[model samples]
Target: MSAASEKSTGLRIVTVPVPLSGRPCEASASSLGEILALFKIGCLLKVTGNQVLAPLDGTITDIDSSQLSVKLKADNGLQLWIKVSEVSLQGHGAGCFTRVKVKDRVKAAEVLFQFNPAMLKLAGALPFARVIITNGQKIERFETTKARQCLAFEDTLFTLYV
Candidate 1:
């Protein structure tokens, strides 16, 4: 469905945070068990691009010391968590450059972090950006896009019914 329909249906749509040229897969408990088990449902987007963007308008709530993860709280009260790389590669010369800090307000499509995909791959990291809805329990209906491929800020990543 289109964002235009969101007003009528009382739904909120969140688009892909980063440009994805590789693939997009469902984030499951098994896949993220090592990272964050709190992510019971989310999306794992292959990191073909070096930069990660804001999925929606939100305030930077928290950022990990290793610069591998960031948490945002959208204006609509939806909480999102984004991880740059695999847990195994954290602080092992993964070379992630984070742009925002806690309490910073961000607009959709704004650059949040930059990293080297090649460097991550060479270090045996999967190079996937994990986007998790931290406050997913508050959502009544959560529908994720089936598209295996997506473009930044253009394709819908998921929709939430509150």
Candidate 2:
């Protein structure tokens, strides 16, 4: 199916993966221009700490060997990507800690992974973790909240309509 055709429906909600207390940074074409251009990502969430949480109820579809990146297929059919480092740092998964595996079922607010923020920083990588709709183009009706909000795990980042 086309990316746009894969959109989620039925009043699905998407959330941030980290605690809002960490001073989250939002991603955009302007703010994360280079990074987004390079990774082909449309959104991002940067936090100061290492813990990563599941942003929605979903089954793990893919996980990188380093465990720093995961792809989740939500119960509502949305595909989400959560990563510790940028695409450039994909090989550096050793600095991260992942708790789930491919095919594992997870709920929103559940702990999925953690990383050594200090180590990631030392490697010249941004500690900005991200929770994004991997198949967003296919989604037709979704509302996203403003970036830079102090959002907790399970806090609604966006609402998807069927």
Candidate 3:
């Protein structure tokens, strides 16, 4: 099916994967700012594998393919204005962090990248990615397509509906 066909209905949630070098922390806080603050120095992030899934997913309503950012029409009529260029990379790990590009097909439950929990702890912040809906609209009702990490759309790192 085309990427558009993979769009999840309001009743279901898609399970995006954790893109990182090492296995992601199960108990890690879910905030991007927190993650950055933890790494005081240039964090030792890892660019390891090609994770098949992305934590973010939605119908590609509008896109700046050249820029990699896309405007998505979410189930609740809320639009997510995401820029691929702004997407953060995972740091503080073993190898170099692989920079992901737009249109690179990803999957849920797959590793997107890895960060150093130790560095984050030392930096005194958390590496958590928070999805903000600029539209200022709220979704009413919906169910997750995946059961476990498959999160209900609100924009999460892994198991997200990118």
**All candidates: CA RMSD in angstroms?**
3.6, 6.6, 11.3
Enumerate residue pairs that collide in model 2: 3-138, 4-138, 9-162, 10-162, 46-128
RMSD of 3: 11.3
Against the true structure, whose lDDT is highest?
A: 1
- Model 1 is weakest, by summed lDDT over 10 consecutive residues, at 13-22
How high is the lDDT of residue 66 in model 2? 62
Model 3 per-residue lDDT tens digits across residues 1-162: 334554544333433222222222222333332333332211111222222223344344553433333344444444444332223323423222333443444333333333343444454433332222444323332222222232322223322233
Cα lDDT for residue 16, model 2?
Answer: 35
lDDT of 3 at 22: 25
The TM-scores, one per candidate, come to 0.77, 0.68, 0.32
List pairs with backbone clashes in candidate 1. none
The true-versus-predicted C-alpha distance at residue 10 of model 2, in Å, is 9.8
**lDDT per residue as tens, model 2, 1-162:** 333545432343343343322444445522332354443224455665567677778899998746377888888777776666653444445466568888999997777776777777777766565556666665546655555654557455655543
lDDT (Cα, tens digit) per residue for candidate 1, span 79-120: 888776664455436776778889999998888777778877
Best by TM-score: 1
